[model samples]
Target: MYPLDEAARAIVPNLRGAIDIPNCGHWTQQEHPELVNTALLEFLKGL
Candidate 1:
Protein backbone atom coordinates (compact mmCIF):
# COMPACT_ATOMS: atom_id res chain seq x y z
CA MET A 1 0.00 0.00 0.00
CA TYR A 2 2.85 2.38 0.85
CA PRO A 3 4.61 2.07 -2.49
CA LEU A 4 1.40 2.20 -4.53
CA ASP A 5 -0.50 4.88 -2.61
CA GLU A 6 0.97 7.71 -4.70
CA ALA A 7 0.46 5.89 -7.97
CA ALA A 8 -3.12 5.16 -6.98
CA ARG A 9 -3.70 8.85 -6.37
CA ALA A 10 -2.71 9.68 -9.99
CA ILE A 11 -5.95 8.49 -11.55
CA VAL A 12 -6.99 11.21 -13.99
CA PRO A 13 -6.02 10.38 -17.58
CA ASN A 14 -3.14 7.95 -17.90
CA LEU A 15 -4.23 5.19 -15.57
CA ARG A 16 -7.17 3.00 -16.52
CA GLY A 17 -7.94 0.13 -14.17
CA ALA A 18 -6.28 -1.06 -10.99
CA ILE A 19 -6.32 -4.56 -9.54
CA ASP A 20 -5.60 -5.19 -5.90
CA ILE A 21 -4.44 -8.80 -6.03
CA PRO A 22 -5.05 -10.71 -2.80
CA ASN A 23 -3.25 -13.68 -1.20
CA CYS A 24 -0.03 -12.07 -2.36
CA GLY A 25 2.16 -9.17 -1.26
CA HIS A 26 4.69 -7.00 -3.11
CA TRP A 27 6.15 -9.67 -5.38
CA THR A 28 2.99 -10.39 -7.32
CA GLN A 29 4.46 -11.78 -10.57
CA GLN A 30 7.01 -13.84 -8.62
CA GLU A 31 4.83 -14.99 -5.69
CA HIS A 32 1.65 -15.57 -7.72
CA PRO A 33 2.61 -16.16 -11.31
CA GLU A 34 -0.45 -18.15 -12.30
CA LEU A 35 -2.90 -15.66 -10.89
CA VAL A 36 -1.10 -12.81 -12.58
CA ASN A 37 -1.04 -14.64 -15.90
CA THR A 38 -4.73 -15.39 -15.76
CA ALA A 39 -5.60 -11.84 -14.91
CA LEU A 40 -3.45 -10.54 -17.72
CA LEU A 41 -5.10 -12.83 -20.25
CA GLU A 42 -8.55 -11.72 -19.22
CA PHE A 43 -7.65 -8.06 -19.35
CA LEU A 44 -6.06 -8.37 -22.77
CA LYS A 45 -9.05 -10.27 -24.09
CA GLY A 46 -11.31 -7.46 -22.97
CA LEU A 47 -9.38 -5.03 -25.09
Candidate 2:
Protein backbone atom coordinates (compact mmCIF):
# COMPACT_ATOMS: atom_id res chain seq x y z
CA MET A 1 0.00 0.00 0.00
CA TYR A 2 3.01 2.24 0.24
CA PRO A 3 4.38 4.25 -2.64
CA LEU A 4 7.48 2.93 -4.41
CA ASP A 5 9.85 5.22 -2.57
CA GLU A 6 8.21 4.32 0.73
CA ALA A 7 8.14 0.57 0.01
CA ALA A 8 11.51 0.04 1.63
CA ARG A 9 10.02 1.29 4.91
CA ALA A 10 8.02 -1.93 5.15
CA ILE A 11 11.08 -4.01 5.83
CA VAL A 12 11.55 -5.67 9.20
CA PRO A 13 13.97 -4.37 11.90
CA ASN A 14 13.45 -0.89 10.54
CA LEU A 15 12.63 2.15 12.63
CA ARG A 16 9.28 2.55 10.84
CA GLY A 17 6.53 1.16 13.06
CA ALA A 18 4.62 -0.68 10.34
CA ILE A 19 3.70 -4.30 9.94
CA ASP A 20 4.37 -5.77 6.53
CA ILE A 21 1.72 -8.06 5.17
CA PRO A 22 3.13 -10.22 2.40
CA ASN A 23 1.22 -10.31 -0.90
CA CYS A 24 -1.17 -7.70 0.49
CA GLY A 25 -2.55 -4.80 -1.50
CA HIS A 26 -4.52 -1.60 -0.91
CA TRP A 27 -7.51 -3.31 0.69
CA THR A 28 -5.38 -4.78 3.42
CA GLN A 29 -7.97 -4.83 6.24
CA GLN A 30 -10.55 -6.32 3.90
CA GLU A 31 -8.27 -8.71 2.00
CA HIS A 32 -6.24 -9.81 5.03
CA PRO A 33 -8.59 -9.61 7.99
CA GLU A 34 -6.87 -12.34 9.94
CA LEU A 35 -3.47 -10.78 9.64
CA VAL A 36 -4.76 -7.31 10.36
CA ASN A 37 -6.79 -8.49 13.33
CA THR A 38 -3.85 -10.36 14.74
CA ALA A 39 -1.64 -7.34 14.47
CA LEU A 40 -4.26 -5.12 16.04
CA LEU A 41 -4.74 -7.54 18.89
CA GLU A 42 -1.06 -7.71 19.58
CA PHE A 43 -0.75 -3.94 19.51
CA LEU A 44 -3.70 -3.48 21.84
CA LYS A 45 -2.29 -5.98 24.27
CA GLY A 46 0.82 -3.89 24.62
CA LEU A 47 -1.19 -0.85 25.61
Candidate 3:
Protein backbone atom coordinates (compact mmCIF):
# COMPACT_ATOMS: atom_id res chain seq x y z
CA MET A 1 0.00 0.00 0.00
CA TYR A 2 2.83 2.36 0.77
CA PRO A 3 4.41 1.94 -2.63
CA LEU A 4 1.04 2.29 -4.36
CA ASP A 5 0.32 5.37 -2.29
CA GLU A 6 3.68 6.85 -3.17
CA ALA A 7 2.93 6.28 -6.81
CA ALA A 8 -0.34 8.14 -6.40
CA ARG A 9 1.41 11.02 -4.66
CA ALA A 10 3.89 11.27 -7.50
CA ILE A 11 1.09 11.61 -10.02
CA VAL A 12 -1.05 13.92 -7.89
CA PRO A 13 0.85 17.13 -7.25
CA ASN A 14 -1.31 18.28 -4.33
CA LEU A 15 -1.28 14.97 -2.48
CA ARG A 16 0.23 15.25 1.00
CA GLY A 17 1.31 11.62 1.17
CA ALA A 18 -0.03 8.62 3.02
CA ILE A 19 -1.10 8.17 6.65
CA ASP A 20 -1.18 4.81 8.41
CA ILE A 21 -3.99 4.26 10.87
CA PRO A 22 -2.97 1.53 13.25
CA ASN A 23 -5.34 -1.31 14.19
CA CYS A 24 -7.83 -0.34 11.55
CA GLY A 25 -9.02 -1.72 8.23
CA HIS A 26 -11.16 -0.47 5.33
CA TRP A 27 -13.57 1.56 7.46
CA THR A 28 -10.95 3.71 9.08
CA GLN A 29 -13.12 6.74 9.62
CA GLN A 30 -15.86 4.73 11.31
CA GLU A 31 -13.47 2.72 13.47
CA HIS A 32 -11.02 5.52 14.24
CA PRO A 33 -12.76 8.80 13.78
CA GLU A 34 -10.52 10.70 16.17
CA LEU A 35 -7.33 9.59 14.49
CA VAL A 36 -8.77 10.19 11.05
CA ASN A 37 -10.16 13.62 11.94
CA THR A 38 -6.93 14.69 13.61
CA ALA A 39 -4.84 13.65 10.65
CA LEU A 40 -7.25 15.31 8.24
CA LEU A 41 -7.20 18.58 10.20
CA GLU A 42 -3.43 18.53 10.42
CA PHE A 43 -3.14 17.95 6.69
CA LEU A 44 -5.57 20.75 5.96
CA LYS A 45 -3.70 23.10 8.29
CA GLY A 46 -0.49 22.42 6.44
CA LEU A 47 -2.12 23.45 3.17
Candidate 4:
Protein backbone atom coordinates (compact mmCIF):
# COMPACT_ATOMS: atom_id res chain seq x y z
CA MET A 1 0.00 0.00 0.00
CA TYR A 2 3.08 2.23 0.28
CA PRO A 3 6.72 2.46 -0.59
CA LEU A 4 9.37 0.42 1.12
CA ASP A 5 10.18 1.64 4.65
CA GLU A 6 13.73 2.70 3.86
CA ALA A 7 12.57 4.52 0.73
CA ALA A 8 9.83 6.23 2.71
CA ARG A 9 12.33 7.35 5.36
CA ALA A 10 14.62 8.77 2.72
CA ILE A 11 11.75 10.61 1.10
CA VAL A 12 10.23 11.97 4.27
CA PRO A 13 12.89 13.79 6.27
CA ASN A 14 10.95 14.10 9.53
CA LEU A 15 10.15 10.40 9.93
CA ARG A 16 11.16 9.75 13.51
CA GLY A 17 10.17 6.23 14.49
CA ALA A 18 8.41 2.95 13.72
CA ILE A 19 6.42 0.14 15.34
CA ASP A 20 6.86 -3.03 13.38
CA ILE A 21 3.70 -5.13 13.58
CA PRO A 22 4.69 -8.16 11.63
CA ASN A 23 2.29 -9.41 8.89
CA CYS A 24 -0.07 -6.48 9.32
CA GLY A 25 -1.29 -4.45 6.35
CA HIS A 26 -2.05 -0.81 5.58
CA TRP A 27 -4.99 -0.59 7.92
CA THR A 28 -3.12 -1.74 10.98
CA GLN A 29 -5.64 -0.61 13.53
CA GLN A 30 -8.41 -2.42 11.69
CA GLU A 31 -6.27 -5.45 10.95
CA HIS A 32 -4.69 -5.76 14.41
CA PRO A 33 -6.53 -3.53 16.81
CA GLU A 34 -4.99 -4.83 20.02
CA LEU A 35 -1.46 -4.68 18.76
CA VAL A 36 -1.92 -1.26 17.22
CA ASN A 37 -3.53 0.15 20.32
CA THR A 38 -0.77 -1.24 22.53
CA ALA A 39 1.90 0.24 20.33
CA LEU A 40 0.13 3.58 20.32
CA LEU A 41 -0.16 3.56 24.08
CA GLU A 42 3.52 2.74 24.52
CA PHE A 43 4.52 5.47 22.09
CA LEU A 44 2.38 8.10 23.80
CA LYS A 45 3.66 7.13 27.25
CA GLY A 46 7.25 7.56 26.12
CA LEU A 47 6.64 11.09 24.88
Global local distance difference test of model 4:
0.79
Say which prediction, candidate 2 or candidate 4, comes out ahead on TM-score.
2
Summarize candidate 2's per-residue lDDT along 19-46 as a digit string, tens digits. 7778889999999999989988988887
Report the lDDT tens digits of candidate 4 across residue range 18-44. 667779889998999998889888888
Candidate with top TM-score is 3
* Cα error, candidate 4, residue 17 (Å): 2.3
Better of 3 and 4 by lDDT: 3
What's model 3's TM-score? 0.69
Best-performing candidate as measured by lDDT: 3
How would you encode candidate 3's per-residue C-alpha lDDT over 1-47 as one tens digit per residue?
56579778778988767887768899999999998999989988997
How does model 1 score by TM-score? 0.56
lDDT of each: 0.76, 0.74, 0.84, 0.79
The deviation in Å at residue 2 for candidate 4 is: 14
lDDT tens per residue, model 1, 1-47? 34675667676555546677767789999998988899899888988
- Model 1 C-alpha lDDT versus the unseen true structure: 0.76
Better-scoring candidate (TM-score), 1 or 2:
2
lDDT, residue 41, model 1: 96
- In model 2, the runs with Cα more than 4 Å from the true position are 1-16
